[model samples]
Target: MAVIDNIHERILATGIAEAGALLDRLGAPGDPLWPSPTWIPMRFDRPLAVGADGGHGPVRYHVTAYEPGRRVEFTFHPRIGLTGTHTAEILPHGPGSCVLRHRLVATSTGKMRLLWPALVRVCHDTVVEHLLDNAEHAVTGTVARPVRYPWRARLAVATESVRLRAVPVPENARLLKAALPHPDLADAYAVRVPPGTSLDPQTWADAIFRNPPPAVTALLRLRNALVAPFGIDRGDASAFDTVARTDRELLLGTDAGHLDFRASILVEPDDDGTTITLSTHATARNRSGRGYLAVVGLFHPPIVRAMARRAARAAVAPRPQASRKVSATR
Candidate 1:
């Protein structure tokens, strides 16, 4: 068994009551503090209370105590072999100031003993620090310095993102699904859109095509060169025509001598987080088209998945701050 005890705290230049108010809204909609859309959000089956049950991402816990605006405690689910409680509280400091603290006390049993220090601990520490940053930002409107994910933590996140399962073309992707009653090939891939991401499908589509990896660009150039002699369409962005569009979905396609294809980018928002789906429909018009499909199909899924992941990451990345011009005084 491995014992785990972790604590993170921040001193805000605000009264205890003011800091406590931030605590009270922990899992509420448009939450100002749990560091969501960047990290998985904290959620509960219902409004936060003593019996409310939920946890962010893979961790599972249930609320065991609530002190209104001052504090809240959660007990871990036993199935994971994690045993203990975690608490978040606001403590009064000097005049017009208070400290917000989060502490976790737990023991890891079974396989978790090995996993805790190697992987879980890094992610947990990073998450807690981000939470503290959010708390400080909420009270003071800025964080002196925000925590950044270390390379290992970033690797873990990227690994997890690549594992997201392929889902069916959403019903909301009406344009793509309706593009052809019988397409020879239909493929869809999805990724979770972080909180505060642009809701426009156009924005995501642009992100997907913008700044592709050098390897991808090189491969595309090779493909275009190889197909040019066959009298095949280059299938570049310039060849695609907008088939249809809505705030939630953008459909683009191209028609060539051997085949026709449509691609849809859809953004669907729900209670937890937004989902972005990329769906494609292609119809073969001849033997050459069928052969082309057979060859390209092998690479289609991974390419779409990579593009979706890239777009999702772009959506959450912080925008560059605008520079201010200095004035010359007389």
Candidate 2:
């Protein structure tokens, strides 16, 4: 079989959902392909019918589907040995945009394929060019919305009010605190510690404090390391308005059925280790086509003050020894 393989790429910007739907316009060039009317060179007359095996003409299409997100697959057979399938897939990157990938799985099945592969290469090139152009127009039509940061406050959760969640390392806490004035971050963190343990809150506190589980794509990786490990399908700490300040917390929501999902871990440093809080009031749409509160009560306040407390302890721990030295000197 002759393998004349050539691949070209491009990126198109469109809504995550719209990316796939736009392909409906160009459709497939399978069964019912029409000649381009002199009137419209750019547009096709009707939709294509990509069917099983081979179609009536020199080329045939067999459309097979295995979709997870924005993926569509269909194959074409010019002949027995010289046949191939085309795969088109789109993946959302951030907010309003996605990535589309198109690949041709071509193989030679006949004596002709073994004799001359150049002809096979030419055919593949012709079909791929048309598909690429269609993809470009599909994405160009839609405006790509700017990706935004996370929500800032509770009330503005849905309205694009993004709260600043720190995505830095604990090792940088001392450096970050020092940047703040006396009442600010640095020295305070160096001095203060949480109520228990040698752990200094301010100096060591980062917006994200922990990462749990070994999976590279686990929730800890997503939360940016702010919260602890949330068991699979469960938020680290779930919180609801069971009352004003705090109450019953359900990580997974009422409408969240059939699907096993995870939630965010909101926590605040108390005299104890940490208070994990999960929110139930907010709602967000998931990949499963269901809606639930994204988070109801997730919070991790600044801990520079906590570090200040620990630093104070370090100063006072040697008081008895200092007193004996004073008596000896007298």
- lDDT of each model, Cα atoms only? 0.77, 0.34
Q: Which pairs clash inside model 1? A: 37-195
Point out the worst 10-residue segment of candidate 1 by lDDT. Answer: 321-330
Residue 258's lDDT in candidate 2: 19
Model 2 residue 305 CA deviation (Å) reads 90
Per-residue lDDT of model 1, residues 1-330, tens digit only: 446788888788999888888898888888888766666678899898989999877788999999988999999998776899999999988998998888989998877788788888787777777777777777776676666676766766565433345987778889887877589998788887556677888777777765565666777788788877766778677544566898899988888887989889898888878888888899998887898889888977877777777767656543311231211110
Give the per-residue lDDT of model 2 (tens digit) for 1-330.
445344533355667577666544333332111111100111222343333332222344555664544665666656555466666677667766666666766766666465334443433343344344445544563222211211221112111111122332233223222222121111111222122222222222222122112332253346545323332243332211111111211122222321322222233444312322221122223432222122312221233222223333332221121111111000
Model 2 misplacement above 4 A: 1-8, 25-57, 66-69, 76-78, 111-116, 141-330
- lDDT value for model 1: 0.77
lDDT of 1 at 169: 73
